[model samples]
Target chain A: MNRIILGVDPGSRATGYGLIAATGESLLHLESGFIALPAQLSHSQRLARIYQRLESLISRYNPEALAVEAVFLAHNVQSALKLGQVRGVVLLAAGQADIPVFEYSPLTLKKAIVGYGQATKTQVLLMVENLLGLTLNNHNTADALALSLCHHFHSRWPQRSVSPAAI
Target chain B: MNRIILGVDPGSRATGYGLIAATGESLLHLESGFIALPAQLSHSQRLARIYQRLESLISRYNPEALAVEAVFLAHNVQSALKLGQVRGVVLLAAGQADIPVFEYSPLTLKKAIVGYGQATKTQVLLMVENLLGLTLNNHNTADALALSLCHHFHSRWPQRSVSPAAI
Candidate 1:
């Protein structure tokens, strides 16, 4: 059976997204890119753009699920608030499309991609490239692809209890 | 000319909304209430509920503007993040409807409704009831109506430059 997954790395300024198809035991990249919100747009406008873009992506690809990074609490109050706003829209888009959403911590993403939870950004990027058999330049896109791959790997191990959260 | 305004007091657990109609020197309360989200619902489900409810409100009232509290930095990082997620959906609903949004600080809300920045919650609620010619029990609804009144008062003074932010 073949399943398509959409992964998103959402931000206030830029939201990166990647799509992949899983067929039996092979993973193939379908698309990867980032939506760049100009500095001139207000915060509300930026959110609107993120929602519209993701809605269009879902419409185009009709993915089976959405994968994203879980909430990271290391940021200060202001930054965390801003980041949460971005994540809110990302989740809203998924909810509107009735697609299941899965969240993976940064450490989990690193381990899935680079075989270690504390792997450096460069190492994760290199390993993702090796796994996907492609050269990637955008860190945001790379992270999004890494998120998709994490879900793919997790879905294969039903005994590990890697089901989507009850959202 | 009569103009409608929607005020929102967004939170993760409950989001309060109120509607007011401005006719010359009079402010009339149209509706006010809070949406209570059960803890059993996940965070994403909560956001989706907020978005859907607000969208229905916008569709029902067709308000000319949305008034909400500005970002309050007093809370800890986690709380701020959760609150921001709620605010994000509020803004998104307004944005999708092409309604302008205005933000007022708590100090400003108190001053507008109670004639002082340091007024107590009871004082603000009483003043809002008096101003709208109604009795209110829900603090969330009271705060939301106060926000609408704040915009009403600010809009009357063109010299104060109380225009909507470029959102």
Candidate 2:
């Protein structure tokens, strides 16, 4: 059976999304990219754009599941709040489409993709490129793809089949 | 001309909203209430519920503008981030309907409602009741109504007419 999973890396100004189709032990990279909002738009306008774009993408791809990063500590509380806002919009879009969302921490995602929780961004990017056999143009997209792989690995792990709490 | 404005008090679990019509320096309350989500629902489900409820409210009232409180200091960074998330959903709903959003800080809202920025919750609630001539059952609804009144007062003040950025 083929299961399609979408991975999301949410940001206040830019959001990255990736699609992967998995069947049995095989996985194929479908699409990966980022949405960058206009600089002149207000925060609300940017969120609106994210919602609209994600809605359209979901309609087109019809993924079976979604994987997203959990909120983590940021240098500034304000930035963390903004990131959370973006994540909210991303979750809303997936919910509207009835897609089940799964969240992974940065450490878990890195470990799943690169075999180490403390792997650097460059290391993770290289591993994602090798695993998916695709060159990534953006770091955010690479992270999103890694999230998709993390979900795939977690789902297959005998003890972790049960999905974690959403959000 | 009858100008209608919608005010929103965004919350992760329960969101409050109010509608008011203004014409020739007169303000009349139209509707006010809150939407509470079940604790069992996932984060995305909660956000989706907020979006749908807000969209329905907008469609019913056809408000010309939306006023929402700006994100401010919370007891914890997690709470602030959650508030920002709810605010994002609120903004997305308003943006989808093409309604211009106006934001007011908590201090500004309190001052507009109770004639002082440091007014207590009971004081603001009483002033909201007296100003709009309606008994408010929920403090969140009262705050939402106060936000509407704030927009009205601020718009008329030549020095405060400039709208704040929507986030």
Candidate 3:
């Protein structure tokens, strides 16, 4: 059976999202984009918009699972708090849809995409494009696609005994 | 006309909530308590529980407005981020019900409840009990009540030209 996965990189001002379908050994990208929220709106207003937009995506894509980037150790406390709020909204959306949600740390995502935990953003982006056979406009979208790819890689070998061969 | 307002003191582990009804100059306390989420659950699961519980509270009280404590400067970035996540969940609940939400800083809440912005938690709790004619078992519920009271005081003088004359 084919499995569809939706990945998200949540941010207060903008949220990146990507969807992919995995069937046996092949992975196909279905959609990739970012949701840019207006800066002038209130925090709650921004969350409401995010909730609605994400809900629409869930309904449209009907992904069997959701994956999101875990919160990193941010230097700015305020920004970190804002990012957490965005993440909460995203989780709530996925929860409402009854989709199982997974999280991948930034380090793990980079390792999956570029064969190195401390890979540069450009290196990760290029690797994602090469793997998915498509060029992405923004790093946010690229990161989301990378998250989906990481999930695909991890889910294949549940035991973690050996890594799946490269796609 | 009578107006019911719900107040929330959002926390990652324990979310405090209070409901009050206002009819003209008189204020009546309806309900007050906290939702304690076990630490073992995943972040999304905890948020889902919070969303469901808060949504139920909104339905039970049928509040016309929702009041929440604004984000405060925290020494720990992770704690602040988690608090923001809880706050976002609270906001999503209110938004889902189409209830107007109001926010008050910790300083403003203390000032509204205890007549001093620098009041101690015990002092605020005592003042809340005196004002509402009930003893609160904990500081969390007191803080939530304080938030609701602050909204009541602020809404009276919509101009915010002058703070409400000592309740």
Candidate 4:
């Protein structure tokens, strides 16, 4: 029985999440979707909702571990700050569930999925579909799932070379 | 009639707010207090509740402008992140109400109210009441209100301070 993993691509406006079950060299997609909070809601409420929704999902899926995108700060100072807020809420949710969570840099996640550090959203999406045999738009959530799957594949390699042991 | 302004001090556990009507060099406290969201609620539900609560307040107060604290990053990275999320929700609230929201740095707010740029949190709480003629403990929220009042004062200052002719 291979371990199951959950992947989350987090954002303030909408978060993309994907779940997969790892079985030896192959992987299975269990579920994936987006969590959205419009620009209209207060920051606190949006965070709270994310926490609640995630909690429910965790209870439903009961994955062995969670893989989330590390906070990214590209150009927008205000956006980075807002992302930190969203990240806080998510950390709390993971903590409450006592689930071990792993974080991957955008570059690492992109490279792991598409063999390149600078994969675009479209490329990542297409690669995820090709790898997973899904005929749906994964968008951010699907991308996150791909990251999770990538991590699993690399970690389980007999060479132990996917991510560093430290990760 | 001097412009009326709403000031917000946001906290994940509790959000403080105040409204002041101003004319000339003086300010009148129209209403002030904190809006709290229990930590137990999911982040999404909290956002929903804040929207409802703020909608009522905005309709009732019809403030001319809004002043909110720019998100601050302190020592604890996690806490700062949570605060940022809460601030986002609050900013969204003001925007939905169609108020032109202004933000002030904590130090700027402190200097305006307490006469010192490096005022302690305790000092800020005390001086906020001194400036606004109130005696209460919602320290952080009050600080937010104080920030609003400070902006109100600064905005009314001779438009000549920063390239006066531009004003």
Candidate 5:
């Protein structure tokens, strides 16, 4: 059995999740995708769909641990609230599986993958592909993989990591 | 045989729920609770357990509608994120039952029951008890009732209300 890890970039509009497994030397990507819930649905309806999708992903991947992106709220209050709700679903999925969850910030993930804390999304995605030896065009999928890679590297070198999601 | 309304005041640490029904010109309080989960659990774990409990509550209460507090943020980003997750569970619970969810805010509820939008937490609690004619202290329970009342009133007179959780 492989030691699998699930990384989630949680958001209300589109939540991206990636599953990866690390061998003694390198990491292998198993699956990655984003769940897009309609914005028009009552917020509750949207959340239900998200929870359902997240649960299915967990069962399908059966990861040993989950690494989700910490909720990032820049300034917009409404956006931040929605993000919190999305993170809730991410955590709920891990909890249901009785798996320990580790949280990573977007910046931390970028720094780990691209060697800079200020790397852009596109830059991080390109570096992730280079590191994984795969050319991925899908931004969400690439971002998810980057998050997974970051978690793997962070787990290996705790001293190089930042304060991940509290929990 | 009553128009029971279930109100939920979701939080990262405790999810407060209340049930009530309108009787002619009065409102009668029913069962309520604080779904307390340890903060040690990862966000996902907390949310999963919350979902299970909320699902049971919805099944038992069979509320006609659900009123949930919207996302409230004030400088504290992590708190907002946690609150968002709980609020999402509230949304998911209401949605799975195909129950229409009504949104409310602290200010609107406080003003409706206490006649002051800026009422302190203590004032709001006192007003909720007086408005609902409760003889005992159920502080969290009262918050739920207030959310329900605010929603009920808004549904009746949409023009006269401002819902905080409108999203």
Candidate 6:
């Protein structure tokens, strides 16, 4: 069976998205990029831009599911609130398109990609590049791709328990 | 000139919305109600519901602007994040419909409605009822109405300096 998945790393200032197609035991990278919102735009305008861009991407990719990193403990209340606002629109776009969403925590993503829950971002990025045979310079895009791959693995092995916390 | 305004008090579980028309010096209440989301719904589903309901209201009332309470210091990080999620969809609906949004802090709302920034909730509600000549039992609905009235007053007197903090 072939499944196309879209992974999103949403932020207030920038949002990264990656698409991957999983066929049997092979994973193929389709597209990956990030949207950098203009600093001049108001908070509301930034959200509208994100929504419109995500909707366009969903339409173009026709992905069956959206994979995103689950919310963990944030640094502060203000940052958490800002992150939540971005996530709200991202989820709304998926809901409007009737796409199922799956969340993987940072620990799960690291374990799935780098064989260790506490692996560094560099390690995860290296493993993702090696597994997908593509060079990714942007950390956000690499993280998004890792999320898509994590979802793919989880879907294949439903019995595997990926703990939210570090193992 | 007459203008219609939509006031929104967004929450994760329940969202309140009120509409009023401002003509000359009179404020006429158009509608006020709250959307009570089922507890069983997922967080994403809750956001979708809020967005859809707000869109319907906008389409029905054709409000010239959306008035909402600004983000203040929240009780905690988790609650702040949840509140931001609700506010996200609310702002998106207004943005998608091209309705201008104006944010007023709680202090501003209270002062505009009750002539005192430090007025209690009961006092604000009473003043809202008196100003609009209607009874409001729901606190969320009353707050939404208060926001609408604040915008009305702010529009009429653009020179008024409404501080974010209490007097």
Q: Tell me how many clashing residue pairs each candidate has.
A: 0, 0, 0, 14, 2, 0
Against the true structure, whose lDDT is highest? 1
Residues A1-167, candidate 5: write the lDDT tens digits.
Answer: 35678877776678787788888667787887787777577777877787788788778878777776665554666667778777777777777788778778777777788889898888987897787777777677777778777777887765775453574
Report, in order, each candidate's fnat: 0.62, 0.66, 0.61, 0.20, 0.73, 0.55
Residue-by-residue lDDT tens digits, candidate 5, B48-139: 87889878888987888988765465467656666777877778778789888877666777777778889887787776777777653656
Please identify which of the two predictions, 3 or 6, would achieve the higher lDDT against the true structure: 6
What value does the lDDT take at residue B60 in candidate 6? 95
lDDT of 1 at B40: 83
Which candidate's DockQ is highest? 2
Alpha-carbon TM-score of each model against the true structure = 0.95, 0.96, 0.90, 0.58, 0.87, 0.93
lDDT of 6 by residue, A62-156 (tens): 99888888786788887887888888898888888888788898888998899899999899889989999999898888888999899899878
Candidate 3: residue pairs that collide: none
**Candidate 6 on B51-160: residue-level lDDT in tens?**
99889989999998888898767778877878877888888888788877888988888878999999999998898899999998988899898898898899887687
Residue A126 of model 4 has an lDDT of: 84
- Off-target runs (Cα >4 Å) in candidate 4 are A1-80, A85-124, A127-167, B158-167
Clashing pairs in 1: none
Candidate 1 chain B weakest lDDT stretch, 10 residues: B158-167
Which wins on lDDT, candidate 2 or candidate 5? 2
lDDT of 2 by residue, A1-167 (tens): 88788999998767999999989988899998998989888777888888888898899989988899877566566776788778889889988999999988888888899889899999988998998899997988998888888998998776974365454
- Which DockQ values do the candidates obtain, in the order shown? 0.59, 0.68, 0.46, 0.13, 0.62, 0.48
The C-alpha stretches of model 5 lying farther than 4 A from their native spots are A71-73, A156-164, B71-73, B131-133, B136-138, B156-165
Candidate 1 second chain TM? 0.95
Q: Model 2 has how many clashing residue pairs?
A: 0
The C-alpha stretches of model 3 lying farther than 4 A from their native spots are A161-167, B161-167
Question: Chain B TM-score of all predictions, in order?
Answer: 0.95, 0.93, 0.91, 0.85, 0.85, 0.93
Best-first order by DockQ: 2, 5, 1, 6, 3, 4
